[model samples]
Target: MTDEHAPATPATPAVPATPAELVRRFADRLADLGLTEAQAATRAGMSIAYLRRVLDLGCDFDRPALLRLAAVLGLEYQELVSGRPEERLHAAAPDADSAPLVGPPLLGELTVPECWTRLGPGGLGRLARTGPDGPVVRPVGYLVHDRTILYRTNPDGALAPDANREAAFEVDRTDPKLHEGWSVLMTGALEYVTDLALLAELPQPPAHGRWVRLTPGTVTGRTIRTASAR
Candidate 1:
């Protein structure tokens, strides 16, 4: 006999490898939705304590309960159980200007914190500087630590910026097929780091000697995406 208090069996979409995996994916999906556990449980017409027991303890949840949670998270019944999203990953951006266009683009800005989150550590970005000859831009590998940009170059090389000089650094990515892309620009005064203690903690490459830092005064970013994506 069916228990009248039990929820109806939700649509089974995909099965997860383990109960823990399913809970973790559900939590991630909830985070992506910007929902709290209580909020999600309330929306799914369940008690907070019971939801917590299931999610935190990795206890088995009935199919009906799973369906309600999936609906609340805006995920396919199976996707809620699977740790990975249904979307496929794409290249960061095209290599050259000659790359074919996918469609007309829509543009938007990313907040400073978001910009830093995207920049992360050890990625390629262009450093712009003003030289006696003229303005110049060159590609460099950069790391973001404590919200400061750090890079390495030969002290005598053109890649090295003079301390106290203003500079601009940029990084961007695009997905032509998805008609989506973003660009981040950081402007700051370059400071050659002299603190041995701090330098020792940073990434040390045997081939590179001089390590410099950019303390950004301005960080601005823009994103372009297809209308459908929003």
Candidate 2:
């Protein structure tokens, strides 16, 4: 039996780039066809969770899982097995750091409710808190209740707890061709829900153990809605 987490015969990392780079390299091609992990999984005749786990496990991905992922990702199986950068098969790598769908200087004020409607579990948000370490961003699941947004993030997510005590969470989806999409940002003060009982009151699965509250103020957002390249 082989472990998916460990390399078959490890020496070092594959890409000078980060795992994020690898994930990004494939995201666009996936999106071009309006494909997501869900769609890819279906095409590959596998489950979404299984595909997700394979990508998440990357270097440690097993033979069968790796094979399935490569097929679904429009990659050749031998390339995945080789783990060689030159052999890298994905072609959608970004020339620069920019979301795929954004083209021009599209900007405006959007509301928190408007943003929340589009933003969900997959997007990451940065937190500004009282701590001296400064802001940090991480992916988080989100929920809304009575116009208030709640996020469950790690304790270390806070930057300067008392001083800023707020978070700026943003999510956007782009389409370089469709020429349009939207960006949503929510700025508000956050309070730690340290109380075990009160924490339970937050709307989430029982598996989520803790989180914080964001009472939004001066909410803002922006939407491209549509754009034309020609």
Candidate 3:
């Protein structure tokens, strides 16, 4: 009888597989093809003796034989061997322009340090808020690093009142005319840094950017870019 405490099987769901598992399963399936061992060996481009030797010794055929066997079995060679989309097998490595997108309006979430890191030296983020009054958006430069986010503002801007509170920031790069590009949104608690000396040391200035520290409580974000721009 089943043990009541036995872990239940998980619900059926799509899953990704690792490479070695693919190789082992393929070998077992090859063993059942409609052919004698000698015939299978010959078609797989191996000497019957060598095939029998490996079989007796319990080793699967090497990659070359597996590849030839796949061909004889009408399989897509690259997909079976590399475990990636056959289309990508011939394509260059993924990048901003060639990568498949996660999906449209790619909604996702990720944890970050108290401060968001530099998106790059040129990265900028926009702060948006919906208070008891309503919604507002403003572009701001950021000096992000481990454990803290830094930036300059009115020191009493719309976002200041929301400091040490929950809020969201968004950064996006998209081609509106052609309806492409990506957008990223981050949500978290916002904390304002009041130490003037610390703010004085932050790296912010396109000439006059100042520093303010924000200790993020939690960060959840997602990226949405073109599939072509992986």
Query: Could you tell which candidate, 1 or 3, scores higher by TM-score?
Result: 1
> Compared with the true structure, what per-residue lDDT tens digits does model 1 show for residues 93-186?
2232344555566677777777876674346789998887888888877766689888877877666767646999999876444446688998
lDDT minimum window of 10 residues, candidate 2 = 1-10
Comparing 1 and 2 by TM-score, which wins?
1
Question: Candidate 3, residues 1-230: lDDT per residue as tens digits?
Answer: 01121112232322223345454545544532322455556667788776544434332345565566555533545434443232232233223243444445533333342113213222467877776678878776664455455566664567664544565676655443222433445666666565677654443333533345555554544333333331
Cα lDDT tens digits, model 2, 147-183, are: 5556665554343234445666665655443344566
Q: Cα deviation in Å at residue 47, candidate 2?
A: 21
Question: Which candidate number has the best lDDT?
Answer: 1
TM-score of each: 0.55, 0.42, 0.40
Instruction: Rate residue 213 of model 3 by lDDT.
Output: 55
Listed per candidate, the RMSD to the true structure in angstroms reads: 14.4, 14.1, 20.7
Q: Model 2, 100: alpha-carbon shift in Å?
A: 14
Report the Cα lDDT for residue 138, model 2: 61
Clashes counted in candidate 1 amount to 1
User: How many clashes show up per model?
Assistant: 1, 13, 6
Model 1: how far residue 199 lies from native, Å: 1.8
Model 2, stretches more than 4 Å misplaced? 1-113, 120-131, 156-164, 194-209
Candidate 3 residue spans exceeding 4 A from truth: 1-118, 163-165, 175-182, 203-210, 225-230
* Predictions in order: lDDT: 0.66, 0.50, 0.47
